[model samples]
Target: MPKTLIVVYADGAAHPGDIAVGLASWARCVFVTEPADHTRAMEPLLSQFGPVITTGSAAEAAARLRPYVPDGLVTYSERALRFAAEVASALELPFHDRPTVGRLTDKWLQRDALRAAGVDTVRCHRIATENDWARAVADTGLPAVLKPAHGGGSRNTFLVTDVGEGLELVRGLLSEERPGLVAGGALVLEEYLPGRDLGPFGDYVSVESIVRQGQVTDIAVTGKFPMVPPFRETGRFWPSPLEYEEEERARELARRSVEALGVRSGLTHTEIKLTPDGPRLIEVNGRLGGGINELSVRALGLNLIELAGRTALGEAVPTPDFYRGRAYFQLFHPAPRRASTLLGIEGVEEVKRNAGVTLYRPYAKAGARLPGGVQTQELDIVMGEAPDVTELATIAKEVEATLRYRFAFADEPGAAVTESSVTGAELGAL
Candidate 1:
């Protein structure tokens, strides 16, 4: 039977058209869906592949995937990654080790595994009750971070500096509804280390290789931009901007963590933080890059999608190099307003006229109330590539300023968008 590539994802604010594009580039057939949007973004791209199947969710699409595709691989999205692993196991197809994937996804379990393997990491503990939380707080101390044991995207993350705050946070956490998590068994509490929040925080390297006869082959690194706290990734920059010495140090530490974790083949998106002391583990996702991988494909000039397909098929792989110069991504963040309608772009002509900006797009439409809180919004994303960060930042600010949305609060007297609290009125998230 011929091989097929399957990618799974949950419907949400934004459709991962980039993931669909990557899968379509390599697989004989591609499938993707966005249940919430009641929309599918891959109808055009999937045409190149043999057959493109669109359904409501990853699980629904999994049923339509042909058994002929003997193997599969998953990229960044947490829901898609786990669903792919489960689907692979059910189909009796070669897939990543379930235990390893579990450890990678759960923060507390990951710390335990690393400690057992003699890998250095921050102190962490798991709790499911008031008694457990108290014990964990005593052991880890005040100024701690609380997170769902198996959560992603920083949905319910809380930072507490004292026991009282911790208690309040715990109460709030217990009260809030979390819909995506399957295992409600545990919550993780860890010592919160205060330092610079690297956007993307660390490099999300997607090492692609084959484990043949117990030998590892093929490895590639995809550098990521520092991310904002609680899993909101601003963007990814390839070939890390670290000095040569720092870069070497980071690579060695990454190698140690990878070997310690026993990752033999496939792609791994590992995050490591450089502290005043040294590098500490920040969890690793056993999959290809999310936005970083896409930047890598363009910057590194590698066919990662195809490479992953070959590896899944048990084929040999080749080493790849980084793109010349630098490639940076500026994630669009809502400037700072609510209930805003995209009034249409104002300075687009001027922005497009500027050099170094390769692409411009607004993922949200007009008349949509911008979702508040530290979450992703379609209006917040404008992807562009440039030779360096300085140029990228300049162009990003210009584009951000140029793109305007009109917002009118229901309680306000008139249809006014300006704010009287601060200097100038704005409608967006920054």
Candidate 2:
């Protein structure tokens, strides 16, 4: 019988489509997801690969998955990481141990461990009350960041330029109902590190790696597009345009940061800021970088999800020569205004006709409600490949110039169409 792999599925999981394809190629794939997800779009898409099991809770999912005696267990959800770690432990399977997963998932714990290990990291404090928030500001000084201690997608993250803003944001967070991954009323306040003042690409970048048996192999450095501020990512460019020495320094920092966190085996994504002083860790993720799998496959000629699955199954992972090319993924957001309905998209055909264009996917449906001011909830994504950074920049500009979005508000009868212009310089390609 073929080996069995159990995947904990969630909406917005890192590379779910690619992960399913990767696992199904090597093992008998079984997906465990929420019942609601099963009834939604994910079910049909995932059903193409293998059987899916719907459960109400993580514990119940584990109970159902136990009988399978899965050879490997994996999850791309930040909320599911701890649960998956527990299930893996019960099954005696290879995984980043529970403690390691905790440190990776909890931003506060991550800061503590990295600092304790003498890793270069910013000072951060946990806030659960107004008093704690004031104390954090007094200690960390002005221009700090306020964010959930265990949150992803930049939800509820805010940049506190002053005490009043910080206090308001913290009070709101304290009163809001907490997500499963977050401790009730808990938030993290950290000293903000400014990135290089280059255009859209911030001074920070993400390092993607696959770790096996306590060894980490750095695979790629991904550059970021200028954020929506208060800390939401807009897009990313792969094989960062960093010079050889800077790239090496980043790799060393990533390896050290991962080692400090005690990650044994899994895919790791580490974000670090290229500060004027040096590289400092932002956070570490115990899975592939979100939206990076497809970019990796296109630029490096590697399937990160497959590599992660093979590592989980205790199989030898082969390191292949990466393709010497550049690729970028940009997000389109309904910013400046919210839309009650997405009427249509124009110039998609022209974008597809561009030589460098590879993938263009729109997430918004005709009747979908699009909330403004959040880049993380972008309505569409465009990815392309080119022989070098220059060509990649050209492609990005062309796509941005060609595509247009038409939206209608509840009070409006006619759709409002607008063309978005994004220049290469504004994209911040290093």
Candidate 3:
């Protein structure tokens, strides 16, 4: 029998269809989810690959997964990272090591670790309670970012332009209304890293890495389009548009940051911003960057998901040396902040008609409630391959322009009955 790998699965994560496809290239794969969220619908996608183990407690889950003799344990969700670490520990499997899990999951702790290791010296303060808001503001000051210390995918993340706005935002976070903010997770205020004017591209790029026994293998540098607002990313392209020197700086910083965080073995996504002063460290993610697998496979003939899974299985994966086939990219038009429910999406066929387009996956359909103001809450994803960055940009813009969205506004009195159609609205502003 081949080796088995236990994947800690959850909703708002790398899709099972994608995971199944990758794991099929290696050892048998089993998915384990907590009692809560959504494995039944995903089972059809994974049925051919392996079973999904859902249990009420960690101990029970460990017991269930133990019989598979899983050689590697992994999770791709920030919310599930710690839980996966615990289960990995229980199984005595190869993972990020139990002691260092906090630095991977908690934004504040992660920053502290980075700062301590001299990888990044970005100043930050933890807001433990509503009362701590002023002190946090004093520490990090205005014109900073305030976000849930344990959050990812931009949930409850905001820019604090003033002290009053900061206090009100903190209150909203500590209130019952923001359930997705991670229960009992303290907020962190950090100095905002201003970005340079990159013209057509976003100011930041991401470095995707696969690690084994603390050795880092950088696969690609992923570039971004300008964020919609506050900080909702719109899309990503492979073979970053950054200058060679800038790209090297990002990869080096990512290497240093990963080592600083004590990531023993796993896939890591380190986001770095190109600021006026120089390249600055953005947050580092312990899982595969969304869209990285697609970009890598299409543009470089690299199966990142497969490689990461193999790394988990104790395989000594090597650094990739590949010539690019083309520029591959993925884009999303996020739901506007005012959107409460999606009434319709139009022109998808037209978007498909665009040259170089490959896939159009809608995240929301008619009559579905819009997931509140987060970058992760996208209306749809448009994927394609272009001859170069210039061509990719043209296709991406055309695809985004061709589609239309009809939404019911959350704050409008008669939004329940009234549906409004618009190309899109800027996020982070209602």
Q: Which stretches of candidate 3 lie over 4 Å from their true place?
A: 40-48, 177-181, 322-325, 410-420, 424-430
RMSD of 3: 2.4
| Per-model TM against the reference | 0.76, 0.87, 0.92
Clashing pairs in 2: 200-226, 201-428
Worst 10 residues of 3 by lDDT: 421-430
Superior candidate under TM-score, 1 versus 2: 2
The best candidate in terms of lDDT: 3
Candidate 1 global TM-score? 0.76
- The whole-model lDDT of each prediction reads 0.55, 0.74, 0.79
How many clashes does each candidate structure show, in the order listed? 18, 2, 0
Model 2, total clashes: 2
Q: Which parts of model 2 are misplaced by more than 4 Å?
A: 14-16, 34-41, 44-48, 56-63, 179-185, 321-324, 328-344, 365-367, 373-375, 406-430
Top candidate by TM-score: 3
Q: Write the per-residue lDDT of candidate 2 for residues 255-338, one digit (tens) a residue.
A: 999999999888899998988777788899998778788777666667788788778888897875533355555545433233
